[model samples]
Target: MELPHSTAPAADRPSVAHHRPGRARRTRPDHAAPRARRPLSAKVRRYLWYTAAAVGIYGASLAYAHLEEASHQAVQATNAAH
Candidate 1:
């Protein structure tokens, strides 16, 4: 079978000097550095906290459902007795 070739010229190919699949690129200082990243704003941090809390609550509910059959049965019995 014929080998696949990149559309980019060899020189333009992403530098293998610091390249690996699933890893970040690290270029020489001579090359222009990438833009600086922004820090998380208060709103973003609050949203992350809320998301973590929601996941924790969901996991606790699932664990309770799996582990506490007695509580569920008591609730059913109470409803039936009413």
Candidate 2:
């Protein structure tokens, strides 16, 4: 009896030339600015949004750190006073 074939057929292999044919096509309009030349208003809005987010995060972190430091200091003072 013949053993069963374990290898794939010749047609199942991929050719090197066919690698990512769809990547060459441009999905965006060519007439539009390339993200860097956007209007100053748009840039300002984006910057403000980012700045607001950063400030919010920083404020939250500062508040948490201050609260933690105050709590630690209070505990230390109470322990020392005992």
Candidate 3:
């Protein structure tokens, strides 16, 4: 079976002259450069470091707790088997 052609004339159809096969149209001009980002303040940096240290300490504590519990269970099992 064949597909039906458009009833409208070629001139009446929407133009796609600006569109390319692979590339997209840019919203801004090509010559325009992006703005530079501002660096974090000393106070903000200190807080970030504090937050990181806290997270690290908490993770270490959790890992230590798990190791201690596993060791305790192994000891109990050994005692029960003897």
Candidate 4:
């Protein structure tokens, strides 16, 4: 009986890495330090924070107005039925 020929050497299996079979390349290359970021001016920072607070307060007031209107409508509906 003739033996079948295998395509790859047993160690260089498709499931394994092209490098060492079990061991990974341990150490990563040290990257360059990140570029320093410019800090925002105090005026710009204060303006942005104030703008955010204004938007948040406006949104809350709008939501409260809608809830208040809905409650008033419900009260009117009950009054009409009585």
What does candidate 3 score on TM? 0.58
lDDT of 4 by residue, 1-82 (tens): 6455565567665664557744475644655766679999999999999999999999999999999999999999999999
Q: What digit string (tens of lDDT, one per residue) describes model 3 on residues 27-66?
A: 5465578777899999999999999999999999999999
Q: What's model 3's lDDT at 50?
A: 100
Quantify all predictions' global Cα lDDT against the true fold.
0.81, 0.82, 0.86, 0.84
The best candidate by lDDT is 3
* C-alpha TM-scores of all predictions: 0.42, 0.43, 0.58, 0.52
Q: What is residue 67's positional error in candidate 4, in angstroms?
A: 1.0
Q: For model 3, name the residue pairs that clash.
A: none
Distance from true position, residue 42, model 1, in Å? 0.3
User: Model 3 Cα displacement at 10 (Å)?
Assistant: 51
Q: On a 0 to 100 scale, what is the lDDT of residue 55 in model 3?
A: 100
Model 4 residue runs over 4 Å out of place are 1-36
Q: Give the candidates in order of lDDT, highest first.
A: 3, 4, 2, 1
Q: Over the stretch 4-79, how does candidate 1's per-residue lDDT look in tens digits?
A: 6855478757666534654455546655777789999999999999999999999999988877887888899999
